[model samples]
Target: MNDIRVSDATQGAAKSAGRKRLLQWLHQIVFVGPATFFFILIVLIPFFLGVYYSFTDWNGISRNINFIGIENYTHILTKDPDFRNAFWFTVRFTVVGILLTNLLGFVLAYVLTKPIRTRNMMRTIFFMPNMIGGLLLGFIWQFIFIRGFAAVGEATGIGLFNLPWLGDRATSFWGIVIVFVWQTAGYLMVIYISSLNNIPKDVLESAEIDGATRMQVIRHIILPLIMPAVTICLFLAISWAFKMFDLNLALTAGGPFKATESVALDIYNEAFTNNRLGLGTAKAVIFFIIVAIITTIQVRATKSREVEM
Candidate 1:
């Protein structure tokens, strides 16, 4: 009788364990399954299809596609002067944009962290430009550059405002830079503020007690503690500057002899305007690889400098 009872107890325990395992599996499927399915459908499938289409000669509207191997890639690397020019222009713009935006953002964040009377109001004012969409902001600045500056020039008799802001190569390049920095710096400033706020007050107090100068404290203490924020800000700045498209379109439209054409804009023109889907996808693949490599290197380099608090 005892053996019979023991067998019945073991069976019950095993059944309970099996039901618990089944419930956990069902819970995971309920929560995670939908996201996984959508990600594969939307992102993964399109990406693989793009990779396959890059080797074929398919116009945007064509149903028939002929495989062309590496011809598009070779043509881009060797013969496409426009793509080359756009690539170089993008490289230069990214470098300048990243540097200026980060520097200005850090400065704004540092100043706002002080015991100022109007710091909150000042932050809101600075960050207001970022709230506007890039396309709208570009249009607003276009008017400012063309009409507003001309009016200011007339009133103030300033040659700087009178110069054709978007009509020339150098001025147009700097024109975009000015607008980009103005729009993005405030966003980065918010990130820096969060990081700066998290820093221990005791550490700063100790540094001050050690007779360290303001600059010295910043260099030796504040910067190291905030390296993670620096890394994040650099990544965001790099991505923004490199992938600049809408603003480039609305502002210059790759105009003034295609001097400010970015890689993203060039890809758009190739696929949609030029009706060469395969070639454009090839360019896109290259652009993705370049951006991935650059951001990876930047992250690794900055992460290495991160100090443990």
Candidate 2:
């Protein structure tokens, strides 16, 4: 009887453990199930479908699609000058945009973090551009470039303002860069400010007492400590600059002999304008791979530099 009672107790405990495990799993499934379902339904399905369609000769409106097996990719690499130019343009824009935005953002953050009477108002003024939609901002700036600048030039006789900003290749390139930096820098400034505020006051005071100059403290202490913020800012800047479309569309629409066309805009024109859906999808796949590789490397490199407080 004693043996039988011990066996029953052990069996009961095992059953209880099994039930608890089952309940935990059920709870997780309940909470995570809907999001997983939607993601698989929406993002995963469309992505796989797009990948499949990329290898075919589908015009995006046809019922029949024939598999072409890398022909589109080959053409994009060798025969397509437009795509090449657009890719080159995107590379240049991304490089310049990243450097300028990050530099300006850090400067703004450094200044605004100081105790100033008008810092809050200045911050709001700087960040207001980001609140406007990209397309809308592009149009607004377009008018400013076309009319506002002309008027100012007439009044002030400034050669810089009199030039055709949206009509020339060099000016259009810089015009896009200016708008991009203006729209994006403030957001990065906010991120940097947060990171700046979190630095321990004692460390800064110690550096000051040790006779460190402002630049020395920033270089040796602040930059290393706030590197995580740098990583986030770089990632955001890279993505924004690389995939810029709406602003490119509304501002210049790849004007001045398609000099400012970005890879994204080229893909759009290929897919819809030229009705080369398969080829466009191929370009998109290539674009996706490049962006993924670049962002991964950037994150890994930056994360390695992050220092503990």
Candidate 3:
């Protein structure tokens, strides 16, 4: 009996060791080995290269580089007013875009989730704008703003249709905003619709039984429940607004006189157009830091209010 017990114990130990060895081999084959190699090749290598280049006085074309330390960063922050204005402009656009896009998207989602004949068709149409390339969308809208709208204005003397949408500073800013909101609101509406669908029918029915108005039910029940989607939409809206370049470029081209220059456009011009590679990269790195900070704060703040429902 003692021999039998000893043999069973030995077999159990060996089986456990065999299983661990198989798992270790599987992990190496599946995750640790390829992922580590890919990260070093794709991410780590380029990141270090960018860090090295940001401190140098090398034009992107040259092989030789002179390390100038923080000079690039200093010039970008203090001496570059264009960069400053572009950053501020992006911030303003982002704040307003976040609020309007999410609010409008939520409303659209709420309205469309009810019984309707062409519900799927409407969703596809709404989502179509997002499928279009950003640059192409901007160019299409540019033509509309410049030629189509201008033609309408000339045809009709009414001030509503005749205003110079992209010719003036104030109007141009709003023109860009309008294009952004129109292109983006529909995409966000789909996200809100998914969240809205998850709300329990019983909960809504109880609220209705208590004689809660539609507005009250939405304000009290639906909005609080869909806070997760709100977080996602708000983050996306801010990032899109801040990084808006192609649209600004194709639509207004930062004209009639640099009035619509955004941070991304300014950096692009500085880096590629002006050959100020170091300064542009410095601006880019700083811009990245600012975005990271803003997204972190926004996500954290919104996450605090999110309910399990």
* lDDT-best of 1 and 3: 1
Model 3 error, position 217 (Å)? 1.4
Give the number of the best model, judged by TM-score: 2
- Against the true structure, candidate 2 has what lDDT? 0.96
Give lDDT for model 1.
0.95
Please report, in order, the local distance difference test score of every candidate based on alpha carbons.
Answer: 0.95, 0.96, 0.87
Residue 190, candidate 3: alpha-carbon lDDT: 97
TM-score of each: 0.95, 0.96, 0.91
Tell me the tens digit of each residue's lDDT in model 1 across 98-121: 999999999999999999999999
lDDT of 3 by residue, 251-296 (tens): 8888777767999999889888998787787888899899999999
Off by over 4 Å in 3: 1-18, 24-28, 31-40
Minimum summed lDDT over a 10-residue window in model 1 is located at: 51-60
Which run of 10 residues does model 3 get worst, by summed lDDT? 156-165
Ranking of predictions according to lDDT: 2, 1, 3
Comparing 1 and 2 on lDDT, the stronger one: 2
Candidate 2 structure quality by residue, lDDT tens digits, 55-93:
998999999999999999999899999999999999999
